[model samples]
Target: MPENRTEISELGEFGLIERLNQDVILRNPSTLKGIGDDAAVIEAGDHVKVVTTDLLIEGVHFDLSYAPLTHVGFKAVAVNVSDIAAMNAIPTQITVSIALSNRFSVEAVEDLYAGINAACEHYGVDLVGGDTTASRGGLVISVTAIGEAQKDQVSYRSGAKVNDILCVTGDLGSALIGLQILEREKQVYLANPDMKPDLEKYDVVTGRQLKPDARMDIIHELREMDIVPTSMMDVSDGLASEIFHICKASNVGALIYEDKLPIDKQTFDTAVELNLDPITCVLNGGEDYELLFTIDQKDFAKLEKHPDIHFIGHMTKAEEGKFLVTKSGTAVQLKAQGWKHF
Candidate 1:
């Protein structure tokens, strides 16, 4: 008889994660959090420790045909750092593990580490320890980041209150736009080996796609200004998806303004060039690595003038429903097309 089977695609990425994590029993009292937040939280003596991990597989998470190994290494660390930033914590240490096939020589691995070290230095985090192993497929990288924050200062996805202002840092949609450009160039190269790819003009979007920087600086600035986000999550799965997570976790709804949505000139233009809607890209595009958060109304004055941060919307009661108010004064239901991976 044939064995019973269920397609992973049917469950999707988040669904698969949820199913796998359903049985992750925490045996230690120190495990304040596990498999749910941007990072796990552990009870420390004076402060809480936030831990996060990310895995990058060749072809699936990245394509080496265009993505340089250095950038891949850098991104591997930055994504984890972004999660720590989402928790309003400062990254302190990281352990990097890599699985490489024989196709990668020692020098190639060293080049990857060069970028990893650079990211560590950039984020002010120490490299503690990790494992190295052989793989039959392409390269795989996984990183675990540890961060610390005062218990009170730690922001959770569940902290948003009604009337809290929804805030997003920097512009959105750039990374997705950048990815389109890269993919287009790759196709061009594959079609004709002699044709040189024209990439110089699309640097802004391509750079955003290739190597994204976590908004750790923004996190630091918030601490310096004595502001704590009521609820926060990193914009790894596009603005709309992250908003839905924040809303669900906090038991609230959000009202975001279409006009207030931030988009880069390059992103908008590229989206138009590719015949993709810029606004749709902003709403559903993923991997910007910016922070999506809600702040108390009283703290708005402190960040009102900050040029990088955008005040996009505010929180509402769950029954009010999640919406995006258009420039023409029409309200539309917000939809989440987060990373599907299934």
Candidate 2:
């Protein structure tokens, strides 16, 4: 007899999410947004509340052998915060839940909390509440972030219009390069137990991986400049993947220039050293935690002087199709190869 079963890999992470979200029905009128975007939008009295959650599991999302518990705890909080930022909302509170195995001791848990508390303080968000549970496997952390924004200020992924300029904050691909360095060091350490990892030379890339900050600064600055993005999402799932999400949600096409993709000097050098394609990493590597958004052409001048923001592309009519114009002047179809967990 032949058995029929489908693998999760066949569906992919985003595909699985799309499949699972099909059954989710919003009964409340206040649920302005649901599973599709970075955060669920709920209508409040004078503002909209953006709620986002993330789950981090050992050996999957992170490896305990290389990642410190404190850094893991901070990352757990930051990733959710990044989602809130993607919605162009200011985070106010967070609930952090953790599942721990017997392998972790009380002090270890406290070390984890030290990082969590530090992140809460840094982000100026209150750690309101959470739940604790015992796990048979390894450490697991789930963070739910609640943020508030004026109804008109919240940027949705579906709001991009044709001709809006696409902008991304900071640089891309550094975090992936960092991860590569970490993995390389791990292999070296495993092969030679007495050899210490030469992490000092690769601090920039490694630090990008170990500790990432969400782009809350950009959101605040945009608010100050009276600039609102037409559409926005965090670059947590690679830049190309995020561009595709905005394109799909907004019913638009994108044309990005290869020469304009922002990559840090260290990130580029390290990627080359690792024998990885720098542009590919920039396009497909995940977890940079930078903001990707589209702004009205009229609002471009207001942000023209910003140091870190890079305008790599612009939205086009949907029929034009998404493309990347290479430095060689060839237009290639863009592909989304985001973080594939399945």
Alpha carbon lDDT of residue 277, candidate 2?
A: 96
lDDT of 1 at 287: 92
- Whole-model lDDT per candidate: 0.94, 0.93
Q: Estimate each model's TM-score.
A: 0.98, 0.98
Q: Give one digit per residue, the lDDT tens place, for model 2 in 217-335.
A: 99999999999899999999899999999999999999999999999999999999999999999999899999999999999999998999999999999999999999999999999
Per-residue lDDT tens digits for candidate 1, residues 3-82, read 97878898888888889988888899998878777998999999999999999999878899999889999999999999
RMSD values, in order shown: 1.1, 1.4
How much is 179 displaced in model 1, in angstroms?
A: 0.8
Instruction: Give residue 264's error in model 2 in angstroms.
Output: 0.7
